[model samples]
Target: MSRSVSRGVVALLLSCALLLTTGACGGGDDKTSASAAEAPTASASFEQQKLAKTRFVANAGLAAGATYQWIVKPYRAGKFKKGADGRTFALVKAGLAGAFTYNRLKAAVNNAKGDPLLSKAVAPLSAGIESLKDLGTKLRKGEAGDADVGAFENIINSVKDAGKSAGAEVVDKVPSASQLGGG
Candidate 1:
């Protein structure tokens, strides 16, 4: 198979694995399941709003972690290591992280919509994720530019600040390279 085709397959497989793992790891409580499935209405209870904010913070940390592991750290080191696929694992990880961040953050934003403070805090993040809708494909194609990275970091910082303002402070939790499939 062509390298590009193989890369696509790897990305697809990894994405599927990520979906499966994440889905299987949920709390499985009624409230958690319900919250994950649908956005709460504007009059959602405090518990639901608090849950949404927590989710928002967690996802933001995940995004930052993935980015640091698969993108920024490698770039700073001046070389991207090849994975078992003989392709730069960083690219695949970057692509996956971008998509994952976008999807999860979007869901978190939607869930937080019922709370004015949480909603406003995530507004900039929502807009930022919108601009990164295609980031996965771009990273996979090696077409992503420095501006993309800059924008991503900026968005992360913006969301963390907003979260703190809303009393939902976020902590950076850079994941291990292996955790992100960089190996």
Candidate 2:
């Protein structure tokens, strides 16, 4: 199959993995096994895959945005920090570090290159890592710039919009900027 299709398929499969914490799929309590007749086993459609990709990315985006804002809040008032708060920064950083090690995010980025909308939003989502890397560098230098902060906010908004475009599935999981501790 084409690369985009493969990516979409991967995205759908990984949805369960992405939401493992929330017990979204089979891992949760399976209290009911009343129906023996299973649905058709056909693969997810292109649209379905796209929706899954959008949902995963959007949730991830909002989480990243919240992390960025959490880390940068001390510096949001036009004041660069000598050092970011260890606990708050660690909250986001540790999670990001874990995601980088995930096959899901990596596969979606590598395989979804042909999907225009998914690909478009993926760039900003990927750039979030770069922003975090910059944060690491800034930590060494003992200061942060407005540009990094602005870029992260833009990335967050892009993620929010992309998720919203997927309809309720994605939008429902995304937190507002204020909910993310906006200034």
Query: How many pairs of residues collide in each model?
Result: 0, 0
Q: Which stretches of model 1 miss by more than 4 angstroms?
A: 1-44, 80-87, 175-183
- List lDDT for all candidates, in order: 0.64, 0.41
lDDT score, candidate 1, position 132: 72
Superposed model 2: Cα runs more than 4 Å off: 1-41, 46-51, 54-62, 77-80, 83-133, 166-183
Among all windows of ten consecutive residues in candidate 2, which has the lowest summed lDDT? 28-37
Q: Candidate 1's residue-wise lDDT over 63-128, tens digit each?
A: 677766666665556443334333455666677666655555565566556457978877766767
**Model 1: lDDT to the true structure:** 0.64
Worst 10 residues of 1 by lDDT: 21-30
State the lDDT at 73 in candidate 2: 51
